[model samples]
Target: MTLVIKPLRKAVLPVAGLGTRFLPATKAMPKEMLPVVDRPLIQYAIDEARAAGIEEFCLITGRGKDSLIDYFDVAFELETTLRERNKLDALEALGPTSIEAGALSAVRQQEPLGLGHAIWCARSFIGDDPFAILLPDDVVKSDVPCLKQLVDVYNQTGGNVLAVTEVPREHTNRYGILKTGEDDGRLVEVKGLVEKPKPEDAPSNLSIIGRYILTADVMPHLSKLERGAGGEVQLTDAMAKVIGHAPFHGLRYEGRRFDCGNKVGYLEAQIAFSIDRPDLGDAVRAFLKNYTG
Candidate 1:
């Protein structure tokens, strides 16, 4: 039997968290809007989705996330000024920020539930099609966009494909660890999922990151709204319910994922990303060397 894979086009970004981690700063601004370098963290996620050929985007947002929606809107006054001043370079830099009308939409998650609840809010936008979920808080730097890497696997497997990375066994409690069935180094068969399992109880060191390509069927499980780990609706728990029923697998993607939700991780991302850029790399590297010296 041939498995038909629906073209993965729609993507959901759940940006509803209050970002209490970066309090005072994030007290007003959505964490997704926090700048990694010159551009906001959310821009990197959107760029990754677009690179993977996602056509429609749904931002599952909450309070104080209005800025996220406004970021993509046309700044007529700003653009007019740039054109009048012949600031072509400045105007061109803003090109990618524009989202075509109707191409983007947002839904509100009124409460601070868990990741599963935030995703469930996007069911209406997702309908019956497969979609990708990207967490802005997790930024990945790679030769190929992380989501595109998973999409490649999804095209071949015709099931759910999630991005996984190996973490220290002792730190397994920090993430959703995977139970394995088969492994080929790059792609591992997902036997089961355990959210934030204790190091001793963790089945494997491989942990699921923020990138995911899931089938529409998982939405039904999320609709059940059963709270799991942390007394919140965990997405891993919902995905677990559909494990044996569908072809679920994890892809060990090629990239460095920074946990922007953590202060140290956010600082690391800034340095790493800045040093990776052609224009900023040399200057940033020199500054680092001199500062440390």
Candidate 2:
């Protein structure tokens, strides 16, 4: 018998939205730059990818999103100034966050197309290997990184895998819902996927999250996919085409998911992360007590 180990080395981050909901803050900064605690939102996504053993990063960006690319670049002048000021700890913090040269690349989405288009822009970067996709808006806090959990499943299945969670029946319209064929603990065999289907029409309550391990074969479907629901080409629609052709499975992630795309979710993430931090837990607890009082 021969053993095979598939290579999962690259991750694509789609970050080209206008972020209109965030208003003035997003007017000057990319939404991904908004801080969850002390670290920016994009940092959390990148950290998760690094934890998953992904070596290369591909960011699909749009106009005025240069700051996101700069965030991961080495700041020689800033490092020098911090070094001179004896801020060695801060300097070291920046070191681990820096993506190695040639390890990170960016492709412009040009238009505010959609998730599918943003991912399609990275076709060259993805080449012929399987790649991971991380949506920074969905910040997952867990002992094991969310993508890493899915990667472990991919190692066993050797096919496309997506992160899935059960949402309320009423909320099925709010996400890409999966139609399941079979369940084996955490892995659910995907029969089909419906994008934001009505509660009555939804195939199953299993809602798809933002993390995915996609095969390169998906490129063709994304390129030719018709715009569905909201006049935009949805990634779900593209993935749906490859369902039975390839072994598509969904992994139910073990963690709390904060949908940082909305104001309420973002605020909740701040409170949740703050309560988890030992340095600020006491003060944060007291503040919450007084706030509730």
Candidate 3:
């Protein structure tokens, strides 16, 4: 059997949700724009995609989300100002980070349906290619890059690959749980998926994270708009339909994941990322010591 790995060229980011969890903070800004350290949440997700060799980005946005698109746009005035101030390094950094003119495209998800609907909105951009789907809420810090690891496994197996992590059994109801099959060390065959099953009903402790490499075939399933657990079209429900027909597996990624969608998780991510910064580590450590002492 000849193995051919289709290079994942495009990635879809569903940023259309009205982030009600953060409330007042999210009132003016898209939740995806919330900063983790210095970079916005979406920027981290885009950086992860860039590290994984993904070239094109398809952002599914909603009303008041123009800022998300503009964030990645070229800032002519800002660049000129930086140049006049002799801040060439800062100018270079800012320009390099914005998505190149033609590299990014956005589609509007007019209604705030669900994750499945948001992804379906980007169907035209996805075309016939196998693409990546990344949820900005689950931010993974890793040396190898989480999506890149899944891409590697997708190449060998030629199937849908999802990033998986072992969550506490008691917290199984909070995540999309995966039922396991033959274990191949890092890649575990996915027998089925249970969306937020009760702890006792969960098939396994392995919960699906936000990173996914899906075939275009998934678009049709997403279009079904079948309401699942929360009366919203669930992506897991669509993913479940494709199990046996397509080779579905989970990649045990090596990394630390932060759920920045919640208040506590957001604060924890800020602390973790701040401590890892070379310039701020000492000061942050000193502050922490003083506070705890």
lDDT string for model 2 (1-293, tens) is 34354789999999999899999889989999999988999999999999999999999999999999999988999999999999999998897669999999999998777888889999999988899999999999899999999999889887799999999999998999999999987889999999999999999999999999999888998888479878888999999988887789999999999999999999999999999999999899998998798
lDDT of all predictions? 0.94, 0.92, 0.90
Q: Write the per-residue lDDT of candidate 1 for residues 1-293, one digit (tens) a residue.
A: 88889999999999998899899899879999999999999999999999999999999998779999999999999999999999999999899899999999999999877999999999999999999999999999999999999999999998899999999999999999999999999999999999999999999999999999999999999999998988899999999989988799999999899999989999999999999899999999998988788
What is the TM-score of candidate 1? 0.98
Candidate 1, residue 170: Cα displacement in angstroms equals: 1.5
Select the stronger candidate by TM-score from 1 and 2: 1
Candidate 3 regions with alpha-carbon error over 4 angstroms: 1-4
For candidate 1, the per-residue lDDT at 144 reads: 96
> Which ten residues in a row are the worst by lDDT in model 1?
238-247
User: By lDDT, who's the top model here?
Assistant: 1
TM-score for each prediction?
0.98, 0.97, 0.96
Model 2: lowest-lDDT 10 consecutive positions:
1-10
